[model samples]
Target: MNAPVFRRVLALLGDLRLAILLLLVIAIASIAGTVIEQGQSLSFYQTNYPEDPALFGFLSWRVLLALGLDHVYRTPWYLTLLVLFGASLIACTFSRQVPALTTAQRWQYYQEPRQFTKLALSTTIPQGSLKELATALSAKGYRVWQTDNQLYARKGMVGRIGPIVVHASMILILLGGILGALTGFMAQELIPSGETFHLQHIIQAGPLARIPQHWSVKVNRFWIDYTDAGDIDQFYSDLSVLDAEGQEVKRGTIHVNQPLKYGGVTLYQADWSIAAIRFRLNNSPVLQLPMAQLDTEGKGRLWGTWLPTKPDLSEGISLIARDLQGTVLIYSPKGEFLTSLRTGMSTEINGVTLTLVELVGSTGLQIKADPGIPLFYAGFALLMAGVIMSYVSHSQVWGLQEKDLLYVGGRTNRAQLAFEQELVAIARELASQSQTAEVQA
Candidate 1:
């Protein structure tokens, strides 16, 4: 690109108004991403947002798919916005913040006494000396510099660099966000107790995401805790991470809100279900039946299995369980309630002895891996430091000694009232010291 064109483009990108507009648009898109379900199937959108009477008259499944609302964060346009915003931050940092900081760091000494008159807070002390003024400023936490008859003092130079640091931190955050979107993956697995499995059911994955294949996770046990009112208090799963050689590398008991993290992946305990029921019938070999979750119409989750009471499959009984508390309800073939049994309990039904062995529970885990989390942590730390630094007032004071008269003036980028008061106090101290020196003379 030509120099003039490049400069124009840089100016455009560095414009504060443009940056603010982009930030607002990005915020709105983020809100939309949160309101609309992401990473869901097409059927889910169609069922939830029907076309006959579209949501808000325009948010149907077709619109969502066309606009990539179903996966907004992973969309090409969304990534483009992020890239553009990052570029804007870079331009603004280089074009504005850096130059401003450089200017603030350079010293500008006031050689002429008249120069002090242009300052925001200036005063003429008839008998005060520049040495006394410098001493007072130094005592007030200013870094004083003396050049013969001219003097300059400043404090809080870090405040000048604060905007630059803030910009750099924001850039890091953007880079981290982009990296996560390009390389993160999320998967869900429903593993029965005592079973080992790998991440296979991938729900969402970025283009560059690497799915691990050399490791597996085993659920050693799954159980639930109940409150005194019989409500579910919490559920837990004892999990073990195994390497390619089938050797356990890590083990932990994970519950809701407490997840297990290994390598780069994290395993969250999300849900649970009854996998199967083991029992014995009429002294026969032990058999297990898979349980199916029935539609409870919002009453609660219920798992059921059918056990044949007769050898010819002519009669059967339904076994229903509401929780992992070991209580199982048995119903007759006619849908009538028969009796309840617990684990290790036995009851005779239709002349055949039914023994309840165990109820195998499965743990639902949501596994995710993101490579940009460290960058995010570092970026946020810098952002906080930068904000605190920015709050510090960058104050500068100038002094000039012409003959026996001293000129003192100062200015600050922020905390104007406090800076003025500090300058007045320094002037008063200089006058007092001058008087004391005359008395000693």
Candidate 2:
């Protein structure tokens, strides 16, 4: 590139206004992503955003799909914005923050007494010795440098480096977000107790996702705790991670808000359902029947099973259960209420004694694997440290002695009033200690 063109490019990258505008755009995009719901199926959008009367009078499912709003973070445009913002941060940090910090670190000596008068806070003490002044400034935490009759000091130079740290942390956070959007995945699975499964029902996955194939999970057991009033208090699932050889590598009992983690995958207990039942007929082997949920049309959730009691399949009984409270309602095939039985109880229908053994429950689990969470946490730590460092004021002081006339001046980039008060205190202390000291500006 030509010299002028390169300079223009650098100018644009370092432009504060451009950086702010990009940040605003990213914020707006993030808000939209949060509100619109990402990674949903096409049917979902079509159902929610019908065509007849579109959202906002013009925006519909078609528009949403056309603009890639279904997955904003993974879309090329949003990723491009992140890349551009990161470039801006790099350019600004290198071209502005670093150089400014370097300039702040290099000390400059005031060679002339007249230079002291230009400071916002300047004074002259007639009887104060240079040794006393230097010692006083050093005691106040200033990094002092002295030469025969001239001295220079500064403090809080870390303030100059704080902006660079803040920018670097923001860049790290943005990179983490981008990495997560490109390499993470989420899925859901429901497995009955004693059944094994793997990551199969993926709801959302990034392009570079590494789907787990060599590992499987088994639901060892699932149970629920009920309160006194017969309401559910909590549910737990004992899960075990199995390797390719079916060897258990990890195990944990996970509940709501408590998740199990293994090999970077986290499994959360999200839901539960009645899966099946174990029962026995008179003088026969135990049999298990898979239970199916019944549709109540928004009334309540119920599970049911039908058992045939006759040889020719002519007569049968129906069983319905609402919860694991251990009570089941039995009804005749002709829609007559028969009787209610609890777990470990038996009933006779058509000369066949049916014993209710146990109800098999399944655990609903949500699985997620995010590789960038550590980076995000580290970035926030740096950002907080940088914010505190930025609060310190970069203060500077200069002193000179020209033929017994002591010239002193000090200033700071921040906390100007406090710096002025500090100067007053130093002047007062010097005056109190020296009998011949006279203070003047």
Candidate 3:
């Protein structure tokens, strides 16, 4: 890139107006995302707003394509805004706060009565000397002192830097957001138990289709815990990282709130489903064929419609038994049971045997990939630094001696009243102590 073009780019990045505009845009877009059901299919919008295809199509497809609302967080424009904001923060650091910090570091105290009368904070002390006041200020633990015809008192002035540091931290946070967006990709999959698969493809759209690849993740098990009231308390899944050879390399547990990290990617236990149901054949110990499993025709065992031949299971009637309490209903067909039996347990009926098998759990895992996290954090730090500097400021008091009298005054960009209160307290304490000493003498 040419030098002029690069400088122009930098200027645009630091432009406050552009940054503010980008922020507003992101805000508006985020609000819209919240208002509209993001990532929903066209049919859902159509069903919800049947009378208005215009609105439905606009929200369902047009807006999604235009702004990447279908994947709002990872949209290029949104990422652009974040980058612009971060650049603005960096620019602000260079253009504004650095100089102020420089100026504050070299601060000197210069005071006079004429300046005092002109000061917003002023006190006329005819009975006390500048040295006495300086002594009083120093006793109050102020580190700033003034000489050369000027008295200076500064206390807790460094406290002003805290907010700037906080702002810099915020910039770091924004930078994190950006980094997490650009170099990051997430792949979602619902893997059924007793099945092994790899995360092979991630959906990334752009000038060309983007396919994201990561180290394979294999789900081992998933479980859910419930509260006493039967509500779910927490959900978790057991997973292992796999090498290219399909060998398990690492293992960990992940939950809804807790995520497992490996190879710079995170896998979250997002959700679960009933993947398959197993049934014992005629009370046999070993013949446990999962009934809810998909058959060649895409029908599960629950559908009770299966061919007599299968690769995994031996050919048979492919029977699935349902529990009927107080009545033994033999159901060979889809909906009807052949006979009705009683509902109580331990009750035996003739001619047929039924046994329950293990229920297979399917786990839903959310996968994420990011490469620019550090840069984003850096921007976040700068942003926080700028904000804190803008909000918090250092101020001090300066005292002066001119022949017969003394002068004391202070000024600060922020919290001037608190500074004044401290100054008054110091002055009053000194006056009271002098009176007490005189009385003792």
Per-residue alpha-carbon lDDT of model 3 for 239-329, expressed as tens digits?
8887777778788999987898877777888876655444443444634333343354654222232323234544323333221111223
Write one digit per residue (lDDT tens) for candidate 2, span 1-441: 999998788889989988999999999999989999788899999999888799999779999988888888889899999999998998899889999999898878888978887899998877667778889999999988999889899999999988999998999899998888789889999899999998999987778999998999999999999999988999999999999999999999999999999998899999989998888889678889888999999898899998889878888999898887778899998879999988899989788998988889989999998887887998999999899889899999988888867788988999899999998898777766665444323
Q: Candidate 3, which ten residues in sequence have the lowest lDDT sum? A: 320-329
TM-score of every model?
Answer: 0.98, 0.93, 0.73
| Superior candidate under TM-score, 1 versus 3 | 1
What candidate 2 gets wrong by more than 4 Å, as runs, is: 334-336, 436-441
* Better model by TM-score: candidate 2 vs candidate 3: 2
How far is 377's C-alpha from truth in model 1 (Å)? 1.1
For model 2, what is the alpha-carbon lDDT of residue 225?
Answer: 98
Of the two candidates 1 and 2, the one with more favorable lDDT, higher being better, is 1
Query: Model 1: which residue pairs collide?
Result: none
